[model samples]
Target: MSDAPAPTAETGTVAPPPRPHAVVAVLAFSGVVVSLMQTLVIPIVPELPRLLDAPASDAAWAVTATLLAAAVATPVMGRLGDMYGKRRMLLVSVVLLVAGSVTAALSDTLGPMLVGRVLQGLASGVIPLGISIMRDELPAERLGSATALMGASLGVGGALGLPAAALIADHLDWHALFWISAALGVVAGALVVALVPESRVRTGGRFDLVGGAGMTVGLVCLLLGISKGADWGWSSGTTLGLFAVAAAVLLVWGQWELRIPEPLVDLRSTARRQVLVTNLASIAVGFAMFAMSLVLPQMLQMPAGTGYGLGQSMLTAGLVMAPSGLVMMAVAPLSATVSRTKGPRTTLMIGALIVAAGYGLNIALMSEVWHFVLVSCVIGAGIGFTYGSMPALIMGAVPPSETAAANSFNTLMRSIGTSTASAVAGVVLAQMTTPFGSVVLPSENGFRTVLVLGAGAALLAFAVAAFIPRQRDAGSDRDPEGTVRAASGEGVAEPAAPVTRQG
Candidate 1:
């Protein structure tokens, strides 16, 4: 064996210098910065109509645009990363974020704001790409915890950004929020270029433009229909038409993907037991995690006149949620350790059960601020475990060449679940309202119903995770040959071949 680290078969480039710790820190920081975009606009959402001089319906596009852009960009970016280079594509993503932030900071109209938000959304692939880079560059011993932290950054940034953004929106010019985001994006991009190495992993094939376009159209229609259903009236012709278009486009897209030589998503590999079940479980876990996000803030900020409302300010509600982000970061190591000892499947199942328990606690004990804090932290811990294990499960099943794409798809599944949760929760709260003077507030029972549904989603995730086939020990050598045999449902018979590393 050579003294240098081995080169991955897909990317012929040798691993960079042994700076695993620095790389992990930089990448995790970058992920957190990218995820911050998801929540940065929430503080300003209610004011968008007045601020932009647009109707409430059009102002809503500020949020919806980001969602649509992110949904389209994530998998496309992943495929590009796999084809060209992960770090290179990561840099492109961060640059887009910086540009978007600056544009939004300068904007006073809906059109420019939408443009900026869409650019910001393109960076959403950073987490999945960062995880792939970790797998490529880090030693086996360090890979697990590093990727776990990377994954956890998604939640941590969202949780932390809420309060940070609320504070800025309250105290300073609204434009200051985007300026701060721009500054953070600049710092993150600089660090990535300075510390992170470009992975040699490349599939080096023709870009799948047809598949990409089809998937983009299908996803936009589907997510748009689901997200705007409440606003457009679920039974309205517009909503129904969008759903029909989405289904038809996706069905055709699936058929095209099956026949393509180099498809955007590798359906065959994804069909394997491990990958399929993990993706399904991921959807449920995502739904469960987002339900608390939707319900807790409203409960926290509702007026005390209502019997069960906590009657806190937006800032306070954000502060209460902040600790959950810290808990998620704190649990990363523990989640990795569980995966190392018990397997990712066990880690996922444990996480699902913990989430269910957390929702159960929220349903029973949500009358106090401390109750919300406790419940949020518990759910955050569970999410950390589930998020950490998902990439491990995905990477273990797919070829090294397909790592970024596979991880991106898994992330997309989680997004779908969250979107679904938001829609369902919105409908429930809208229909189940209590009268307070002339105004209607979400009834206490409405919140409880949503919590119950959250618990159900977690339990469903646990059931789905239970079906994942047991994987080999993480410490074992993971050669390309072993991956092929495993995908074919055969026992591992050979050790991985060692390719020489230059650095």
Candidate 2:
């Protein structure tokens, strides 16, 4: 085995070196908490209708609000981090996570809860920022495995958070969920402060306020239109207006990005085949992953009177999902092995295909509770591989100095996928409902429809994955932000590879 590589400081900085192994582990663990905070509220969804005196449709906003906020914030934060530093951005995000969780825990109404969720969503930016930091700070030898593990955490924490949320909500109160998340955030913040070194890589550019506002407004309107169209009626003025605003703002933003010398988003480079293809696949993977989150909980928690429901309580339902996360944990190393052998492109394609296969089977096999668990296991496995492959693809496509920005852009794409999935699934559930006196309940058909959509998303992801270039080991590629020395003790040389992908 190759000995661990050293972390070289970026030019003009003289920070002390961190213990690479310890820093990597701490940062990776922090990721698990960040991931958990994203979905820890799902198990408590059932209680929201009663506690907030709201309908299920209204209660769903708890999830949708966070998704919207995170989707808007991620890319902007990432780009800003590139202009500033990844470590600095991460610390800011953690503070937001902690504050958001605490606010959510203290909330007494649905409105306040939504406010808290939006705050929590800010931390979602940390995921990509952390991945980018690995390129800047971690040893080259550990980069592959470290990044793969962080990717796995995205699924792992979500999977595990289900059970934790259920247990806390059942035994205590929903407030406890936020409290735990807050604690996790604080711990992550502290660890990051101690273990992670600040980025010496600096791009002296001003923040693009106009570009950020445009992207934010566009994403919010677009996601809101999708998520609420079912409830608001697709033809209603509200829905149509939101959609129009989303399209117009996004189009204008694209044009503005081209004109701006220092854009909030670097559209030119992002539109390159390698980056573009990877981001498209990332969106599909996000869609498929969110489908599981949306459909499974309903299947688990619906009343036993419903023929499709397993009739499990929130706690039990969460427990079932919890075990699935372990499957994803097992998948990371396996994906690493596949990535090394066939390359990241093949590994990602295979992962997406597996997800499609699992969703297709879910359509046929979802009659029983155990079937849900089995299907979740397959989905978890698929997500593990797909998530593991994405960062590697992004890292390979961009210069080391731009790692945080590039990864953040990819993360933004995934968030867009999740937001779209949630919106579409909400629409399906709303339309396919069983009338029960004054109340309407979602029927089995709704979930099945969502699963079919998920299968299509997986297929699309597979197609995108096909376009990513296979990794070559012909020459050593060093971080553009750091100095490089030849193995033979020769003077520092030119970087062996260009950051942009070759057609």
Candidate 3:
């Protein structure tokens, strides 16, 4: 086969085909659905204890189950998309979303609901595919803008889904929330079929069944251990065994991958200082984001008798989070401009700093509903900027053929971060609840502790982003074979030098 065409940036020497705005919209909408699935159930999580006859602690697993599945599936799907056509895999993911939602809507038992969440998690690959699609379909002039919108879709879908979920769950039954998601999934599926074009760049390789299965088992064990630990007892044999199994499986899998051709994940490139550091930062942001999502709703929905709560209904709490989505949407184009003006590294730094500031503000000003809303905008801006720069960094660091897989790996890191955060946050809340309490809810002290943890995570993310070495957009530094060279003090690869001689 002839060489695959290079992605046409406005400044790229070669230009790819021009994609219509409708196609871009379709790609972005798919991303929106993936993001919506991540947070749409938050309004109902606190109420799950009452609605499903489960403990509040047990109900939290519903969210973590979804996170685990998504984290494991994302990189696999990206690798599959790289081998097969992205359009084919993306369509399959949408089908999973529809089926998952319908199943969840019809189920009365938590068992089937957990099953549905795992299936829905399959859709997490859509965002990475959308980013990959931009490189294939959009001209150079549009790629940056299109990628920026795809990044923002994450925060936008999350922000918008809350109010809609709140409205439906409040007026109708909680099952209605899943039913609505099912309907939206059907619509999104149809739109994808109608508007999205098939990818021209497809690689030939067998699916790495062994690698995929190993990673899946390891991920499931790790996530299950973390998600259920508080309920299962941290020191219990079951949890301890799961942790040991996960560690062993993942370690063996990593070694296996290094020896295999067409590995499920290109761990060598992914482990590069640049890619590894960026992924670490992505995880921290994901952790902080989920921490905020969990804390805010509980605070907003608790009865007015609680000195720390505003006593708002679920619908009101959802509404408070809704504006953050709109603000995130508004910030995307701005992020694009920032990337062009100051480069992705600088843009990411600004975003990380904004997140730290937002968390700091939350520490000082979370008493009133409006205060929470105001702080959310700041957080949304941070998300928009940070999300946009991740792809730009990944795209510029790896070869063109590795784009989707690299992006998906980044997404997977974020999911892992979120899962870890959910687990840790649960532990913090579980430990910090006041003994003198009545029904015994997480007191103001629990929330303060969570916020402090979130702020510290954001600061760690900032440190990671701060240290990522600056590189140009051409990506020539990494070369087609994925080599790195050390320079004077910084680990700068010599872009202009011959690839063979540099390393």
Candidate 4:
């Protein structure tokens, strides 16, 4: 019950006790578990209408609901983490996942299923929260690779879970998928409770209820329109109205954030050159990454008679994509080393170039399964590098107090990019289709065009990364709390002012 010892001027910040590895492992596991939810229902999406006795369009909400909920919850949860506690909020997120999984498992209708998916989506903050926790608790030496692996978990779980989910959906009752997720969520939550310690870095303040509400409304409107715009008809009044509302709400929200004493997101900090450029680059990288996901699967499964198609089954396609996840895991340490030596900016540029190369390669080699594997692995490795460096860049630029919120904002940028990619790819494929008997399918040229666009996005990210200002050694320029230290003529270090907190 007694308070722990505080750091002294001589000892500096005391490192946490010797369980860093365990902490990293548990956190990375939690990230993977959370990401698994993204693809858990993909195997069953096509059958949802029949199974739930709903229209296909209505059944599609099962996916759209999760996307909208995650977009709204990620930054909100992150801000809450900064105010209250990251670990506490993380546990709450996992609990939502568990509850959602159980609900979905028990449901026989679309209503309950949609509810459960939304709850699961609320858990998407786990990755950014985990990254923020690493920034606070891990040794400076251990932080880079730990965060890289944590970021890579997003791709790792999605790629790996597809095959697993397909296997489950094919062999067992579809309900078993949610049941498995529930078990995994329970394990992840318990591990976090036992292994992760709450940090001393709380940004104590009254919750910004107004800012939070504005952000939620704006993001919900914006993302809802983006995710469903194709279905609603891009030029339809419903879609256009939502877009206009989002723009107005976000403009007001931005003005409000700038004026507020305690805002949900610290706009001035985010406006810093380093943070701004990195976030911009993240969006492009995210767009590039998702385009591959959109194109490769279709190319792999289109009947072999299509000339370019590999004619693989859903399960086979998932298996082929699985190696990319493994490759990403393998690259994390190497990515960390590159960031350590050459700086994260260089690492990011290298990653962007690699991704562009991957897409370029895919354009030339779409005829064989091995070619898809090669391209995916290349892109995954690049993603591993880019994802790894993003947290380092964001953390280096922001105060420790705002770590979770800033990181969550970066994650949101990536999601926005992916959502945009989905929309763009959907439109391209829908517009350019080949007729086969009574049905139509996306043409090979349409898939090629998507891959070409993916390459262009990666190049764009590389161009943006080139503008980020260079920095000193990764951890040397910033203090334990991420406040940049200034050098004085007398050789004493001066700390940047702490971020303001209002009750």
Candidate 5:
């Protein structure tokens, strides 16, 4: 359909081509399994202090450790995947997830539990690595829907994990949760070993330890301040110190990156008008998406007597929200279709506008059970479109050598957006509370305010998407490395055709 595989220097023979469907299926499964880690412990978060015999504040570290670990691991793993092999790093990540789950499963104390969570967090690079794999191995036509399905796994796993975890926490011993995760990790890893192929599209160089260290320290500091600011008191010396250190360290890191020949992230490529603006929009879309996740569950679980609350159980709320994830999956092909015809820039703008409209509708629709379902489905469809298109926009601009690193950086920007959304939503909900007997809870107006903010963020994303430069010439998009594996026929399919010329 495209070109024959290029000969290798050593053997002068082409290896059997990878089965693109098997590769995509395995990688997507691995991504969804790894992403399940994000929401696995959420159902039990309220009882963590009691379960672990620790102060509520200390127990929050269970979640915070994973966030910090993921922030540090994601970009580093991507760089390593590019330097070494994506499939190899993917296996390593799955191993870490297995180990982390076993550790958490065995733990009776906070210390062991925290160790397990950090290991789980370290596995966060799986999704980006998986996307890079799809770009390497899949044919042009299959690539769009494949990448979209892989990206959507991030939300799919979280959405589905909630109800499953709630059901487990409700009936069985909580340790079963980690045990099942470990089992899923095992299945995912074994499937990967059997089905996925290691790509030869490597950046092959000495690891940039200094740059990696700088990035790790800077991101840890920044995320720590943002995540803990509320508990530590926003203006406290500790919080301020962390923020100041983050700002200074990141500034130095940016300057250092530009000077290094093989920096952790190529800021020049990142600064491309398309890459930069798409990343900006990614932040807003991520914020808007996570806002819905936070608001919907709480609103659904709140007491019915509160006038607007649905008075559903955690399991019920999760079930109510589950269809959104299914909707996201259902729309993957549709997203690829639109992206194929209109260009990813246009698709992203359409997605942002849809998300904005969904939020606007949510403001008026908050009173009914079916309303939550309908509103979530609308927003989920938008997310499906945006997530599918962002990677296309990114890969089109970056060379093959930088694919994993570039995609990982983009993923990190989304993480920052979600984290910031959590903080901002927490502040608003805290500030606008109503008394419910002995308990003080967020008022209906607080949720409406957050919805308004989400709509505004989505609008901001649409504005940013509007400014991304139009698609580049097909050949111009490739050959950034002066050569590509796709160009050489190095045992893998060419980029499912240049992203621009696909449809």
Candidate 6:
């Protein structure tokens, strides 16, 4: 076809079209940078009290604040992206990230650091936004792999971040970490402005401030209760009370959404078999994925005196696991191929099985450093396959207009799964420890249990994916080429005129 931008069916306006490869590269780069926030401070997590000059418990908020902020921001940004513009919100998220990085770089206290971290967390929506942009712009044939690679960036950034952060922490001032983050965010933002174009799809409506408030309150309460339950005591009144409040708020919010003319999350769309099941599978996959993270690092770094421990340094541990990230990147194209041929549902089920098998292998081969590398790479491949298929399944089910919101909600499910995994694994390890002189160490059996649980979670994902109806059963009007015939020209109305071309 032509190199020039063509008039979109939704909005008959001609704008400059970015080259497809340039668009994918810029968006994927932006996604990796944004996901890097998840692990940006891992090297300093244990030393937060010393670096921030605060009480140990208080300094923990630096991490918790980011978690809480991201949980609230993901869906909100997705909805806003659908309403205003994905590119607009993407720019806003990047700006917040840069601002946050700068704030943390200059801070030497806990309060300021927590504020900075929260701002950084708010940028987590960029991945979902990137997926939405690709769907709107790319050809159907390229859509599967492009979005899969975008989705896999979450794991890729996280896996790569550990070694990078460890090396920087060892060689440079801690402040340099945030400075690097700031610089990276600036570069990603600049690239996006240069190459990404604003998609013409959008819905016009008042921002659902009430629904937004409700979701924020509900998610914060629910996630806080889950993440901090081990710390605060699972049965503590505080935990129970937060769960109670979350239940009440979410129920009210759901009812309100159904009654409203325009909703924050289209409950109706989300309830579709494909979307709902894929989201559930995402949670299980997330839980399974996180167990490897929790177990591997500690197993690698534990004192050699412990017969089961490999006894490596933090940098060594990171380097060993780094291959997993590369493996994830490599699997992105494979994942797309599987989805294209066998369908995303089949791809998800197969991925979950592979993850389960990887965990099983991990249990059998825990003594050697190479074993760790091998197991991580295997599980990483499984995770890549599953992650790659998720956006395809989601996009196939929901309208193009709600693409960002649906993907954001799916991402949120994964976050919840990881948080739950952290809490559950923490409790297991704490209760089942070996006494090594004055210090207590996590028992070898305890690690085994975590791995087994990871396998179980993966199996659960397989079961969930099995429930996702095939596209024909789903009864959506889609072509064999994977274009949604039902969705064409059935999205949000376009704005009267271009406000500004920058987005």
RMSD of each: 4.1, 4.1, 5.7, 4.0, 4.0, 4.3
Could you give candidate 2's per-residue lDDT for residues 163-267 as a string of tens digits?
887788878977888998898888899989888887655554788899989999998998888778877889999999999999999999999999987888778
Worst 10 residues of 3 by lDDT: 483-492
lDDT of candidate 3 at residue 404, scale 0 to 100: 76
lDDT of 5 by residue, 1-503 (tens): 35344344345545434577788888888988998888899999999999999999999999999999998999999989988899999999999999999999998789999999999999999999999887776655666788888888888888888998999999999999999999999999999999988877777777888899999989999999988888788999999999999999999999998888778888887997878998999999989999999999999999998998999999998888888888888888878777776677887898888899999999999998999999999999888889888888888777666778889999999999999999899999999999999999999999999999999999999998999877732222243222233522243234443321110
Model 5, CA-based lDDT: 0.85
Q: What order do candidates take by lDDT, descending?
A: 1, 4, 6, 5, 2, 3
Q: What overall lDDT goes with each candidate model?
A: 0.88, 0.78, 0.77, 0.86, 0.85, 0.86
- Model 6 sits at a Cα RMSD from the real structure of 4.3
Candidate 4 residue-wise lDDT at 361: 97
lDDT of 6: 0.86
Worst 10 residues of 5 by lDDT: 473-482
Q: Which candidate is the best by TM-score?
A: 4
- Please give the distance, in angstroms, between residue 491's alpha carbon in candidate 6 and its true position after superposition: 4.1
Q: Give candidate 3 misplaced runs (Cα > 4 Å).
A: 1-19, 46-61, 435-437, 473-503
Candidate 6 lDDT trough over 10 residues, lowest sum: 494-503
Clashes in model 2: which pairs? none
lDDT of 4 by residue, 20-118 (tens): 888899999999999998889988999999999999999999999999889888998999888888899999999999999999999999999999999
Per-residue lDDT tens digits of candidate 6, residues 191-282?
Answer: 98998888766776778999999999999999999888888998999999999999999999999988897888888778878888999999
Error of 4 at 350 (Å): 0.6
Q: Which candidate is the best by lDDT?
A: 1
The residue pairs that clash in candidate 5, if any, are 139-496, 140-496
Tens digits of lDDT, candidate 3, 153-211:
98889888888887877789888888888888888889878877766555557788999
C-alpha lDDT of residue 87 in model 6: 95
In lDDT terms, how accurate is model 1?
Answer: 0.88
* Cα error of candidate 1 at position 56, Å: 1.1
